[model samples]
Target: MKRDIQSFLLYLFGFLLLWEWLRPVEQLTKTNHIEMFIIFILLSFAVTFLRLRWIWRTILKLWFILFSLNQFHYQDGFFQLGWLSSLFGELTNNFGMIFAQNWAGLTNVFRTLLFFILLWLMVYLVRYWLLNRKRIFIFFFMTLIYITVLDTFTLYSANVAIVRTVIEGFAVMGMLTYFRILAKENVTSDSLITRKWMRPLVLMIVFSVIVGIISPKFAPIWPDPVPFLKAAADKGGEDKAGTGVGKVGYGADDSQLGGPFIGDDSVVFQSEAVEKNYWKVETKDHYTGKGWIPSGSTLLRFGGDEVIPVFPIHSRVETRDESAALHHFMDYTHLIYPAGIQRVQFERSYDLEMDSTKEKIIILGFDSTPIAPDSYTVQFKVPKYKASDLRQTSVVDLEQINTDFIRKYTQLPENLPERIKELAETITAGETNWFDKAKAVERHFSSSVFTYDQTNVAVPGENDDYVDQFLFETKIGYCDNFSTSMAVLLRSIGIPTRWVKGYTGGEFLKYSDDERQRPIYEVTNNNAHSWVEVYFPNQGWVPFEPTKGFTNNVSVDFTNEDGTPAAAETTAPVTPVPKKDLEENSSKSKESDTSFTFNGIWLSIITFLDQHWKWILLSFVMAGGAVGIMYRIRGKWIPYLYLVQFRLKKKDENIGKAYLVLLGQLERYGLKRKEDQTLRNYARYIDTFFASREMSKLTDRYEQYLYHQKLPEGSWMESRELWENLIKKTIA
Candidate 1:
C-alpha cells in the first residue's frame, strides 16, 4: 500500500511539471485545441504507464518519437504534398514565391518543436553518457558548439520565440546537471544542489555576461568599404553607376562623381584630425540634369594624390622682414588661412617632390628660396573684421552651376504629394535667409509629434516612397527619418543641405578622488547619430543636429574677465560628472529585505499553527519555548538540531549493540537464547523465569535501557561481556 501511494505521488508530480512546461497558446482554433488536447492526454497516459516501472528511459524514448514525428510533418500540419502544385504556383506568382512562403511557414513550426525535443535529449544524453564514460572534455565541447550555433542561428533569423526557448533549455540543462552531480556525490535527499554546482555555474554565467557586454567594442574594429556600390554595378550596366540609369544608380557613368547620393544618414567623411570638424572632399558648383558635380578642371598631381584647387592664388614676390611681428597683432594663433592669402610670404621655398610610390607630395626646403610650410600654423586677424564683414560673398552663378547638381534640389518625383510641399512652405514662410528658414524647419521637426523609435521604423526599398510613409503613417522613426525629412525640405527651398552620420557624446565617468579632474569617455553603439549640415557662406558647413533638440539660440559664449568676447574658439571640451551609486544600494537593500520577509512570514505561520494544533502542537510549543528560553539565557541552541540528529543516529546504532550484549548475558545464566527475539522481548521472557534479586536487577536494567533511558555507546555490550567472563570463570 505504501509503495503504491509513493508511485501515485511521483506520477502526480511529474504530470504537474509536464503541464507547466507545455503551456498552450490561447489563439489556437477550437478544433486545433481539441486535437492537441487529445494528443497530449494520450501521450500523458503513455508516460504515466511507462513511468510506473522505468520513468527515465520512457521519457528519453518519448522525446525521440516526437522528434521523428516533427521531421515527417514539419510540425505545422504541412508536408511536401505535391511538387506540381508548388511549381505551378511559383511560376504563376513569380519565381519560387509560393514555395518560399510555404517553406518559411513549415520550417518555423518544425524548428520550434525540434529545438525543444533536441535540447532535452542532448542534456539527458550528455549527462547520462558523462556519468558512465567520464569524458568531460568531449561533452563540454559538443555542448558548447551545439548551444552557440543554435543561439546564433535563432538570433540571425530574428526568431524571438525560439531564442527564449533556447535560453530556458540552457537553464534547465544547467539545473539538471547540478542535481545529478549532487546525487552521485551521495548527498542526502533533503540537501539541494546549491552547494555542489551553484557557485561554479554562477561564475561561468558571470564570465559569459562580461564577454557579451564587451564584445561589440572588440568586434567590428575594422572598416568595410561599401559593398552596395558593387552590388548595384553588377545588376545594372556601367551607365547604371551614373544617376537614373537603372532602378538604383550602379554603373560608374550614372554614379555621381563628387560623392554618393545624400541619403538621410549619409556619411560625408570620417577623419582623425583633432582641430578639423569637417573633412571637405569636393564642392559642387556645376549641376547636371541628375545631380551636383565639381567644376574645378585643374587637377594638380602631387605624387599619386589628386588635389583639386578651389581657389586661385597668383602673386608671391617677397618674404616680409617683419612677419614675426605679425603674431603680436593677431587675436588667435590657431586659425587656418585659405590658399589665396597673398600678403603672407613664404619664409622658405622647397622643391615639390612627387612621391608616386608613397602617394604624397614631399616638399624639400632649400636655401635658394626658403620653404614656406605647406601646412602651417597661422595667426588670424580676428577683431579687425566686424560681424558685418564676416558675411559670405557668393561668387558662382546659381543657374550656370551644373544644371544636374541644381536639379537634385528642385526635382521632385512626379508623384510627390502636394501636402508635403505645402507643409514645408508653411513652416518656413516667415524666415527670410536660407539659414533661418532651415532653422525653422528643424525646429518644426524637433518640436512636433515625431519620436525616435527604431522598432517602429521601416527601411527604404526599391519601389517604396519611405519618406511619405514615415511622415503620414508611422509618426515614429529613428535619426534617418529626422535627417532625411529636413534635408528634403531645405533642398526644396533651394538651400544646399546634406545629411551627416556620426556618434553623440556618451555617458561620463568621473574620477573618485578629484572633483575637478578630467573623466574617461566610454562610447557605445547607441550613440550612433544622424543630423544635417547646412552650408553657411563664410562658415563652410555648419553642423545642426536637430534630433538632439538643438535650437538656433543654443550658442557657446566665450567671454573673458572684463566681459569681452573672444573669437576663433570653435571646439568645446566636454566635462564628465559622477553618477550616483543608488542602483547598487537599492538592489542590495531589496535582497536583504526579501530574505528577512520570507523568513519572518515562515516563522510567524509556523508559530500560529503550533499554538492551535493538538498532538504535535505541544511538542512544537515546547521547542519554541525552549528556543526563547535559550535566547534569553544566551545559550547556544542554534546548533541544537544538528546535535539532536547526531544523538538519534548514535542511539540507533547502540540499540543493535545492546541486543547482542543482552544475548551474551543470557547465555551466562545457562539459558538457551532464540535468535529471532529482540533484546526487550527476550528480557521480558527471561524476567518471568527467574525471581532472584540479581535477575530482578538485570531485568530492571534491561527495561530501563530499552525504554526509559537512551542507550550509551557500548554500555550494554561491555557490561554483559564483562559479566559473562566472570560467570564462566566461576562455573569453571
Candidate 2:
C-alpha cells in the first residue's frame, strides 16, 4: 500500500512537471484562461490515477471540457446552452476548412477544442510512460528543450525555470529509474528500501542544482542566432516564405524585401527641423528579382565637416540653405540627412567613409566602425524642382547621357518577366517625358488599386519576381512593395531609378523644444521606410512616395514654361508677407494641418482594418492552430522522420536508436507485443508478421550491446539496414 502511495505521488508529481509546459503557453502565446487548463489537468489526473472505468473517465473529461468552454467564451448567462449549437456549427465549418486545406481559416473555438485534445493526449502519454514504460526521461528532455527554446527565441527568461526544472526533473527521473530497477528485478517494493534509495537521490538532485545555480558560467562563445534566423525567415531577399510578421525597424538588409511587420513605437531619434522632410540613409542601385542589393561602391574618405559631393545641383533646380539637428536616443552611427545634404557637423573630430554608388555614410572611429555620437547637425539644400525643368527630360535623346551611368541605375535582372515590362509600358503609354512616366507609375498604386499593409505582404518564392507578385496578385503591401514596384516598373522602360531607405518625416511632437527655432519630431522604428528616387539630368535624383497614404512632402515650384515661379503657389517660408500677418496665418495654418492630419490618420487606420480581415484571421489562426497541428500529427510524422534522420547517420550510436524506433513503428502498425514478452520474443513475433528474419537478428545484436556497450564498428552499419528494412515494411 505504501508502494502504491509512492507510485501515486510520483505520478502526481509527473503531472505537475507537465504543468510547467502550460505555463509558457499562457505567458508566451495568446492562450488565455491558463488557470482553467490547470483545473482540467487536475480533473484528468483525478479520473485516471484513481483507476476509474474508461467510460466514466471519458464522460467526466467531456463534462469538464464543456463546462470550461462555457466558462471561457459563453459568458452570456448561467450555463449558456446557446453556445453548444454555435460551437458545433463552428466545428463543422472549421473541419471543412481543414478538409479544404485552408489551415489559416480555422476558428478560435475549434482552436480551443484542438488545445483541449492536446491536453488530453499529454495526460494519457504521461500516465502510460509512468506506469507501463516506467520511464519519464523523454518527456523530461522534451520539457527542457521546450523551455530553453522559448528562452532563446522569445522574451521569456528561463533563468529560474532552468534551476527548478533541473531539481524537479532530476528528482522525478531518479525515482522513476529506481522504480524501473525494482520492476526489472521482479522485486516487491518495500517502503523502507524506497526511502533509503530516494533519500540520497533527493540529496544529489538538490546539491547538483545548487552547484549549477551558483556556478560562474563562461560567456557566450557565439552571438545570439535569433536575428539571423529572423532575417532568413522574414520576407527579405532570401529563399524563404514571407509568412512572418516582424516588428518594424531600420533593418540593415534590404536583400530579402517582402513581408508584414508590426509597428514598433520605440524611439530611434529626435529631430529639430525647419520643415519635416524624408531623411535619406542609403540607396541601392541593383534590384534582384527578390529584393535590393548595393552594387560596387567607390569609397570616398573625408573628415566629418567635409562637403559630400553627391547629388550635384544642376542649373535648373533651385536650392535654399537649410540645417537640421538630430539627437539619437538609440545606439546608431549612420547619419540621416535630407536630399541635397552638403555636410554634417559633429562636436568632436571624426573621419567618414562614403559609398559613392550606394551613398551610405559611415562615421569612422574605433576599429573602423561607425562612431556612435549622441547628436549632430546636418546642413542641406532644400531643392525646389521646377515644373518646366522636370518636364523637359525626355528619354528620346539618350546619346547625350553616359552609357555606364544609365546602365548602372537602370539595371534589371535578365530573368525579369516580360509581363512586368509590358505592364510598365501600359501604365506610362500616355506620358511624354521621363518625369511624367515616373509620375504615372507612382499614381497607379492608389488606395483603390493597392492597400498599404504591413502584415499581409508576401515574400516572393524561389522562381517568383517580387515586383510581379505585388503588381499582379497580393496587391497589398507596405513601403518596400510599393517603392520596389515603382522602381522596377520605371526601370523596365529605360529610366534610371534606384531604391532609397530612410525614415519618413516622423510624428511632430511640439513646435519647438527648449526655445529652439525648429519643430521637434520623434522618429520611431515604425518610421523606418523606403521609397524610389528617379534620376534626371536637370533635377538629380528626385524622391517619390509610391506607397498608399504616404506623401513625400516635396516642396515644388510650379514654374511656367519660361522660368517664372507661380506667385500664388509659393509656400509661406518662400513668399513675402507682412510680419504680424505671417505669424498669425502660419499659426492658423499649422492648426488646420495638425487637425486634418490626426483625423486623416485615424480614418485611414479604421479603413485599413475594415478592408484587411483575411490577413488578420490568418495571423490569429497561425498563432495557436499551428502549434496544435504540429503536436497533433507528430505521432504519424515522427517515424518517417526517424527513417530519414538515421539514413544519413554513419555513427555507431544509431544502432540503439534505430532499434528503438523500429519497436515504436511496429507497435504503431498494430504489432504490440505483450508486457511479459522479452525483446527476443518480440523480435520473433515481428519477424513472423513480416516473413523476415531481419528483426530477430537485429534484436540479438541489440541485446548483446546492452550487456557490453562496445560492439564491432560495423555492427551499426548492418543493423541500420535491417532496422530500415523492418520499419519500411510497417509503413502502410
Candidate 3:
C-alpha cells in the first residue's frame, strides 16, 4: 500500500511541474491543481522513506516497460507529429533561429534520430548493468543528476543532449531492482524465474518514455497574430482589415519572418521617401501577463466583381512642388489595401492591371513623378472625422466602447502593491479624458525617473508583478513591461486602448537618373517597436508612443542652400551585425577549444592504459586495458562473464598439464593413450580398475572435463576434479 501511494505521488508531482510549465502558454492557473500536485509529491516522499516494497516493485515493473517503448517511439518521427504552428513554436523556443536561419546541408531530422538512438542505447546499457547489481539508490541518484545536468546544458545551448537516455536508463534500472527484490522475497528459488509480473512491467516503462520523447506539432485553428498566407489558404479565406475586405491575395507566410517582436525594440527600415518615416500596423487591445493580445475578433468581407466605391466630391491632389512628381497607378480589382484610402489621383497616371487569380493590382510607371500637375484633382473625403471633433458629439455607443476599454486597460493584479496603484493615480490625478490620462501615464513613464533597460526584468515569483517591478524597484525594462503596464493603466481609467507592434523609425533614400528619380526602403529588426493605440470611436485607432524619447529617432532633410528642393540627406546610426552572426563566431571558437581538449585527453588516456596495463592484468583482467578503462570512465562495473571467461582459460591450461602427467602414468601401466583419447574412457578399458571406486572417481573427473562447465581456478570444483584424477593415477 505504501509503495502504491509513493507511485501515485511521483505521478502527481510530475503533473504539477508540467502544469506550471504550461500555465503561461494556456493562460490558466488553478490553485486546487497545484495543491493536489503538492500533496502527491509529499505522499511520494513518505512512501519512498517508508519502503513500501510491493508498491515500489509494481511501479518499477511499470516504468521499465513504458520507458523501453518510449525509446522505440522516439526513434521514429514523434516530435514532428504536431501541426505547423506547434512545430514552429517548439522550434523557436528550443532551437531558436540557429537551425531556421542556417539552412545548411546537414540533415537535421536524421541527425536528431541518430542522437536519440545513441542516447537510448547508452541509457539501456547503463540501466541494465545497475539493475543486475540491485543498486537502486545509485541508479536513482545517477538518473536525477544526469537529467539535471543534461537539461541545464540543453537550455543553455538550445540543443538536446544524451542526458535524456541516462534518465530513462536509471528509471528502468530502479524498476528492475525493485521487482527483483520483491520476487526474491515472495517466491522460492525454484519458482522465482517464472514471476509473471516482471516482463510486462519492464515493457510498460519503455513504452511511456518513447511516447514522451516524440513531440508532435499542433497547428492552431486560427492564424497566429499575423495571419500566414498558407494558413489562410487552409482556412479558405482571410479577413485582411478585419472589417470588410475578403481574403483577396494569398496570405504571406510570415513564419520565417519570426513572430512579431514581443518586447520593445527599434527596427530600421530603408525608405523610398527622401525623409525617413514610421509605418504602423495592427495594435493590441488586451494585455496578458507576458505581452499584449487582441481583445476580440473582427470579421472582414470583400465585394466581388463590383465597381469600387468612389465619392463625388472633388479634391485637389498634387506632388509636393519641392520634388519631382512620382507617377503611380491604382488598380482596385482584388487588392485589399488598408481602409480610409481616398483617391488614386496622380500627377501622372501609369498603366495598371488587376490579376484576380493572383489577387494583386500591378502598376508600372517611372520611378520619379513629373512636376506637380497644373491642376491636380481628386474626389475624396476623410473616412472619419478627427477625434477632437467626434468628442463634441454625445454618442452613447462610442462612450461605452471608450469606457469598456478603460476598464480593461487599467486592470491591475488583485494583489498588486499599493505603491504601484498610488503612482498610477498620482501620474494621472488631474487628467479628465481617457486620452489625457493615457498621455499622463506615458509622460511619467518617459520621464528620466524611469529608466529603460532590458536586463533588469524581475524573475517570476510572488510579489514580482510586472508593473510593480518596472515601476518601483527595477525602474527599467524593455517594451514588454512598458506596453503591458501602459495597457493596464489605460484600461483601469476607462480607455479603449490596445498595444501595437511594428516597424518604427527607418532610413529614407532617393535615387535620381536621367530617365526618372525614385526612392526605396530597407527595414531591419532594430526598427521593431511596441506602443499603445487608443480607439477614438470615430477616428478609428491612433498610435501613442510613450517610449519614443528614450531612443533617438533619425530624420532626414532635403533642401538646397536657398531652401529649395535638392536631394534628400539621410541621417541614422550605423547598422550593427545581427546577434546570430556573433553567436556563430563564438560557437566556432568554442568548437576549436573542445576539439583540442578532447584530442589531448583521449591521447593521454590511451598512452597511460598502454603502459600500465600490467598492473591491471595482475587483478585477473578478462578484457583488454582499453575496455577496462572505458568501463571505469563510464561508471559501469566489470561484467561477471569476463571473470568467468578468465577462469575458464586458466583451467583449460591446467588440464593440459595434468593430461601430460596422466599419459606418463598410463604408459608405465602399459595403457598409454593417444592425445585424442579421454582419460575416463581409458580407465574404463582397464579391467583391473574399471569397477573400482578409483575408476569411478577418475570417470567423474574426466566427465567433468568433457561435459561440466568450467569453474574459476580457486573454486572447490576445480580442486575436486584434480584430486579425482590424482587418485586414479595412484591406483593405476
Among these predictions, the greatest TM-score belongs to 2
RMSD of 1: 23.3
Per-residue alpha-carbon lDDT of model 3 for 104-126, expressed as tens digits?
Answer: 53344333333334433443343
Global Cα RMSD, each model: 23.3, 24.4, 19.7
lDDT at position 628, candidate 2: 89
CA lDDT, candidate 1, residue 673: 67
lDDT of 2 at 271: 86
Model 1, global lDDT: 0.40
**Cα lDDT of model 1 by residue, 1-732, tens digit:** 533443343333333333323333222111233234334444544444444456665665565445444453343432444643543444455434445675454433344444445544543444344333433344444434444443342222223333333333344445556546555786543335454565676566656656655676544332211222223233223223343211121122311211111111112112121121211112233223233333434323221122312232112211121111011111111111211222222343334332221112233455332232533322211111222212232332454345554454344456555666677888988655665566578777766687543322343334445455556666555555666667666666666665544344333434324453333333232333445666544444344555523222122334443656543443243321111121234335556754443322333343354344575777898999998897664322322332243344433335344444445545644666676776546655655555323334444555667676655566554444433433333234
In model 2, the clashing pairs are: 236-256, 236-257, 237-255, 237-256, 237-257
Clash total of candidate 2: 5
Whole-model Cα lDDT per candidate? 0.40, 0.77, 0.41
Off by over 4 Å in 2: 1-133, 137-245, 366-368, 396-399, 513-516, 559-732
Query: Residues 498-591, candidate 2, lDDT per residue (tens digit)?
Result: 9998887777788764666578878876677789999888778888878776777676667576667743444322211211232245346556
Candidate rank order under TM-score:
2, 3, 1
Name the runs in model 1 displaced over 4 angstroms.
1-155, 158-400, 409-419, 429-436, 448-481, 492-495, 501-530, 534-545, 551-732
